[model samples]
Target: MARAQREIGAALLEVTRHADVPSEALRDDGLIEAIPELAALGETPQDPHWHPEGDVLVHSLWAADLAASHALEHDLDADRRQLLVTASLFHDVGKPQTTRRMNGRISSHGHAERGGEVFRAMGRRLALPRPLVDAVAAIVETHMAHLSVRGDPSPRAVRRLQHRLAAAGTSLDDWGIVVRCDGEARGPAARPDASQPWRRVAARLQ
Candidate 1:
């Protein structure tokens, strides 16, 4: 079990540090061998209407790559890059558990909230650092913030989200990064306005 944990840690490290496109870091078999649940993420289905690209795994890898590019293009420091890449990798880790056919449509309602709980649990089980665990979990939980405020968003709503992120040891900027990548990772028909989350963050939630 300890060896397995190290392998898991090592695989994650490879993706976080070495892979420009994260999935490229692992040899084909290395990922599923080191981390099976992450592999299971590959089997979980998403609605084509929103994810014509494929499963949660495909979206995740794409998002992570986008995040890596963003970090590089914007000159984000190593710590911030790690946080963004790791958060993107784990953003939808809860989908396999929460997904279901609902009213004839594929839905993983409440997945972001559930993803946060499951990520925290997985991080503890892996003996990961408390700060890393919390920050990633917070990002997973709120990655959907822009959608929740779609159409017209209230200042109070924005401030509440801002405070929640701050309390979690991350901030709106980090959350916005995840949000933008997530939106961009989807099929064209399903992608939200990538600028929306940034607009709210730029407002300073005042």
Candidate 2:
């Protein structure tokens, strides 16, 4: 199982590094099939108002694209860039199991926390490095913090989020990139001002 997980991880890494990874590759290369958790994302519904892209899988792909583009534009180191891309791919891995309808709206309450668990489990199953696994899980766990901060641009909230991520072994620099890419992938329903609060958080961190 360990060996199989390593092979799977390697394949996923290659797919993410491609300049133009087709959505088909996700299925063709067995990424979606071999990983049941990822496969389940296809059936996960999201709030259309927040995710015009339709489903969790589509949104995740868009996020991965944004992550890849940003990594190249910023000239990030290879390993760091790969980390961002991988995290983007699994950022919403738990949405399928967590989705629920509330007040005539779709919501994935605690999806981030659930996603962190899934990410950590995959990392351990794949025998990835401890640091890498922990970093990715930390990013998934706090992926929603940026949106919350956007809704309420309070300095106290920003500081608290920063402290939370720092304690979880994620840097503000990496967190900023992930959050910005996530917002950019929200399709037509995305708000231009969504990144502003994160920008302020970045400044505070510096």
* Candidate that scores best on TM-score: 1
User: TM-scores of all models?
Assistant: 0.89, 0.85
The local distance difference test score of each candidate is 0.78, 0.77
Clashing pairs in 2: none
> Model 1 — TM-score against the truth?
0.89
Candidate 1: 10-residue stretch with minimal lDDT: 189-198
Across 1-206, the per-residue lDDT of candidate 2 in tens digits comes to 43387888777767666644535567687678777777788889899988988899888888887888788887887777777887888889879878999999999989999999988888877667677778888889888776663254677776776777777667766777777777778878765645466666557756
Clash number for candidate 1: 0
Cα-based lDDT at residue 149, candidate 1: 51
> Model 1 off-target regions past 4 Å?
27-29, 190-198, 201-206
> Which pairs, if any, clash in model 1?
none
